[model samples]
Target: MTAHRAKGLQWRLVVVAGVQEGLWPDLRRRGSLLEPDRIGRDGLAEPLTPGAMLAEERRLFYVAATRAADRLVVTAVKTAAEDGDQPSRFLTELGVEPRDVAARPRRPLSVSALVAELRATTVDPAATPALREAAAERLAALAALRDDDGVPLVPAAHPHRWWGLYEPTRGEVPLRDRDRPVALSGSALHQLATTCSLQWFLGREVRAEPPATAAQGFGNVVHVLADEVASGGTPADLSVLLERLDSVWDSLAFDAPWKSRQERENARAALERFLRWHVMERDLGRETAATEHDFDVTLEAGGHRVRVRGSMDRVERGPDGRAYVVDFKTGRNKPTAAEVERHPQLAVYQIAVREGALDGVEGFTGRPEPGGAELVQLRIGAPKREGGDELPAVQRQPALSSYDGDGEWVGELLADAAGRVLDERFTPSPGRHCDTCSFRGACSARPEGRHVVE
Candidate 1:
């Protein structure tokens, strides 16, 4: 059993293997942050000290060994030939009697067969001569150790079969520099000033997030339903909406059965609320003209033209001939009016629609003149009314707004943010969001001339 999962677990015969010098306690490396704790200039607590780390590792191993109901057998390799393979000092510290046991051949402990298997899969059998020689040496050493008392060695194979046998980039495969503007999305650029530019750079260049949770998944399904309904193909009946919602829900692959059921019920309630909202919009002479409209808008930022791109969830035409941009939020965590007033996304979209960003289209002969933006929030829960029956209520809480037509804030904000990015200085601005940041493990808020250097 692995050490992590073996905690508080006991067996009639408990054998703790691989108690070697380089492992077990696995002491901290020489240059590691383990000398004395020091807070870095970034205000992030940078701790140090190998002694404390070793003590903690020892405590865990000690607990694992002591969790024996009947007998405890601690074993290590005593490879006299290999310089580093020595018994763990913890066994000697316990004053346990030394006893040599013969090695037993097992299905999982095949060293020669592993090399053969890898060679068979390789494109060229003779390419991995170094790997084969190393495998041979390990097998010979294990054969010598079989005559002595030590832990039986097992070959922990590499995760990939063709790890060492491959050609580096050749021919037409040319690596490209990441800095060249595959320009960052509008949403990405907007978030840079709010968080740190470093966070955005890390996410764009290094790694991406995994599939979202159930709530997010359900929200995406609702987005698709909204798109379909806005396209004017589907009839706006409750049964029709539910049927489409159920079909979309069924199309999604949910790993958890209970989450699927729960999200479905929640999505149904949200869709019902959305249908009611749609009726009100129609009554107010608002007609959805666009759904999932993609746009690439160029704006003056930092004395140069920078391209910003994103998709609008919905665009509607009012009876007064004014056009509106609408975005849907399935969760109740709607931004306040103050927050929305200065929000980059709304401001940018407002300027884009005003500047004929989505002008030429196949839908109609006319173009949209910016009215403003709205965030439609869908509720799947029913909050109780004061001094009333406990009946459930589904509702759409919308935040509708209109711009005064003074659209210069969009240019100023974008110019400042884009200038900082183009300057190539990425600094971490720590705040409440840092706690939930996925890149928090590697986040260091050190001073200038440190990681902030491009």
Candidate 2:
């Protein structure tokens, strides 16, 4: 039976076992824990300490055991031996005495009964490779450890260490002891908040029925568009798509008409900008001119040779032996030049580009060519006018365009951000923005609410 089906059902006989550490209620990876701002809105204060989590597991066991209608049989294997046995803590708490079930005599079974239990289960061949590889690796690691007095000393396992594999662009160099771990940036956090707020807002209207128009179903439309772009599909028939989307959007009921209109427009504008940016970047990758997108840039930084495989959105060759690597930003909120300067991701990209880690796209080989990088903000919507009768309003100019060419400046920013992430120095910067944040209620910075601890 599926876990969902078991959620609310209580059986006449209930059995709960496996309440060991790292088994029940599973331990979360350090990096998997959300930031205070993200957790705040969810009404969670602080993350659950390991001790609290263990206690919660025990409590869950108690709850499960007490839910039985008549008989309860809780069991646990204390040791891997003929005489080894132990009672679960919850069973002890319930005053149920431990009994040796393994010592019971075995009864002879009929051939049909044995045959019925031996039925074969189908296995997918494609799944074997990964499973075999995982088994081999685990066995090898186990073999490397020495047992102390017959007790296996499993090597210290850091689940979050796998996070490094996800960041291929970071190269193979180990981070220095002084370097901080990376956490979700402000922009990333804001994006999550915005998505949560939009979902909550849309849920209220769409509860009665499905969205009837694309404009009304703005969130769904944007999601579809993002999926299309991520899959490298052409977004050519936007008009037809928008029409269908508007139909879905119009079906939803909203608290305020003007607010709904603004939100719908905003969602549409963001989707359009993202699609355009993705298309432009894809096109650059296929360009034949010196502006080609595919490149391999490599650099030596912090005692590691970092190699980046990607195409720049735009490349402009200058007369002074300088090449400009341009990246497009379709986000609505524009930060000041000073704010841009402090942005870690942009800084890292600039360093990567300058060090030739991204030079392969431009057909360059050997050492990476030193060049500048520009963060260009592409305006997605038209500027507001006092009064205008134009068929389509003129689009507003991009708010800010920032540039950073200094490698040291970029590295410093990354280092600082990385340090904060490692140190777990998360602080909530709440304001009107908190309204959009999913973790707003769980935030420590929220003056009026209790913090959530998970």
Candidate 3:
């Protein structure tokens, strides 16, 4: 619709403006791509002279005019560059007569067109009596916001402010390609933010991580076990499941053997319960979609691109044919539904499903969108050691704590946060979690009021 971009593309009514003298067939007398002296057999496959560039320009305008299927309107204003303008000399060459705008009498202003013009503008110009009235009406409408808040809540800074045209903010940093790529999971983004400076340092400076705790190590083991069993339709009996567990356990890197053993026993009890729950759910009609699904997606935010990866524990296809992403937690202090709604890991899986990343995945023939997600709680079932006999301290159960939300919104939020994490300016935000975080040692080096660790 802009100029001759619609060339060879027909429209019912095509309007061409600046069909005036100096604009179209914008003859740049100086620098054209075609250089005759530089052209030779070895230069390029096909080369043209300066004259040809102008010739092509004429042909483009011709093509622009002929694109009208029904009617063609070629117009030219009375001015160009603040100097008086004239119709193109080519219009006369084409035997088209010109009409003078100054000669025509003014017609009645259109109410509908005036309303349309006002609707399209953020700030209305009082072009005429009608438009002035329209502008007044627009002001009145804006004064009363749709929400209870009188003013619309819009961010003063672009979420991806690093990409703004201007230079960096007074003390802010800009995003740049680093010594290493920015790789983060949705889970990392879901954590509490202490400072912008600290996050930036962790991403760029400290890329490698230390070993996980026994609690974390056990969760990883269970995830691997769940993925393996769910992928295979092997019998969910105690012996087979325990053997698989033993194999998985042997391959793990635990914080301590004693702690690992304690977790392994708890895991074994939970696995049996999960198997029963898994089979029963299937019998009730939920089918497996994908397990241990790995995704690495590149997102473009505020012009910067970053790669995010996450492994989905399970994605189930319901009888309704919609999918649900599930992540397993085997440790204590499992998050609730509200917490899962804020989990970046699930949001990532949701984005992947919708973006065709999981198209060829199991049970997603046409790429069905994820309906929702849940944290598959498989807490440890350890018994209290009291007196001679041991008693179960907690019930053995596996439940789906559903996160009620819109996938697209959560995905967008993560994308913006990823952009910020990748952007320059790693502001440190030290908080209570720093006491246990390995980076707490580094936080102490920061300015006061933001010291991160114990």
All candidates: CA RMSD (Å): 20.0, 23.7, 25.8
Give the C-alpha miss distance for residue 263 in model 2, angstroms.
Answer: 5.1
lDDT of 3 by residue, 64-158 (tens): 87888898778776754556776776566545687766654343345434433444352345366676666657644543434565554222211
TM-score of every candidate relative to the true structure: 0.54, 0.34, 0.49
Candidate 3 whole-model C-alpha lDDT, 0 to 1: 0.59
CA lDDT for candidate 2? 0.46
Error of 2 at 424 (Å): 3.2
lDDT of 2 by residue, 333-444 (tens): 5555565544544444445455554444444444344354555443344334611221112222221122233345444334433443333343455556566444555455
lDDT of each: 0.65, 0.46, 0.59
> Which sections of candidate 1 miss by over 4 Å?
1-184, 250-255, 361-367, 380-405, 445-454
Which residue pairs clash within candidate 1? 34-49, 35-49
Query: Which sections of candidate 3 miss by over 4 Å?
Result: 1-183, 192-205, 248-260, 298-306, 380-412, 430-432, 445-454
Q: For each predicted model, how many residue pairs clash, with residues at least 3 apart or on different chains?
A: 2, 49, 11
Model 3: per-residue Cα lDDT at residue 106: 42
